[model samples]
Target: MSEAPVPTGLFSGITRLDHVGIACRDLDASIEFYRSTYGFEVAHEEVNEEQGVREAMLRVNGTDDGGATWLQLLEPTRPDSPVAKFLERHGEGVHHLAFGTSDVAASAAEVGGRGVRVLGDGPRPGTAGSSIVFLHPKDCGGVLTELVQSAR
Candidate 1:
């Protein structure tokens, strides 16, 4: 068997792992757990009505360089919300992995061009004023993937 060559420029804009989204039944409890257990501190918190999630971004360690990776705790605000549906199906655990990108729209287009399914028509509003889009799990090795362009 022969190995296939890696494609170029498919994820050129991806800079780093931005955050790991964890679906939770209670946002406050999850925050407290991470705080007491791992000493992680909340960096930002917001309720995104469009996504139907009350989310908090926790800094794993200290944010000395202003580029610390975050642990995003997401709690559903409604029964029909995506977080709620994920919790119902998989219980409390990781929901998605977000990668930091310099340009989400361009990155999504580039990846989509390679046959990976982009979940929406375009990038949408994300936490902390960032723009985000999800790549379909079926095309992403069964793990839901998110691309985030941090607010500038």
Candidate 2:
């Protein structure tokens, strides 16, 4: 029989905050806001149809010194999509925070054991062809959290 997966203790296995996802009513406005307020630089941009949203990655300035980490802006393609719902409810703000982990499935399982609810039972394909999993907001202190395995 295959051995059961082991949980890493309290996300300690995670090394850093990969990115922070923000659901925006207006992608251009949010991008401008981040630029004007924080001077972040755009690193990547793509439209993900499977996720039904368009996204952009903005590298946080001085992140090596503990400044703002990478920021992701998500604009929904449909009004019924999750990002749209989030905007309707929260009014353009941070949606989730992604953590960089070596083994996302193991860390997710560990967090699940602690009564945290993960969106998926296991890792799944995400934007840019990366593996990822989302944790329920209730378990993350009201913040939706995504665990992402590096593309490397």
| Candidate closest to the true structure, highest lDDT | 1
> Candidate 2: misplaced stretches above 4 Å?
1-12, 61-68
The C-alpha local distance difference test score for the whole of candidate 1 amounts to 0.89
- Kindly list the per-residue Cα lDDT of model 1 for residues 45-140, writing each as its tens digit: 999999999999997743223456899999999999999999999999999998888789999988899999999889999999999999999999
- Show how many residue pairs clash in every candidate, following the order shown: 0, 0
Give the 10-residue window scoring lowest on summed lDDT in candidate 1: 59-68
Cα lDDT tens digits, model 2, 1-152, are 79985443354457668888989877888888888997886777888776778988898644332333578899999888888888888887778899877788888877788898989558887656668999999878888889877665
User: What TM-score do all the candidates reach, one by one?
Assistant: 0.89, 0.81
Output the TM-score of candidate 2.
Answer: 0.81
Model 2 lDDT, residue 110, Cα:
77
- Global lDDT of each candidate: 0.89, 0.79
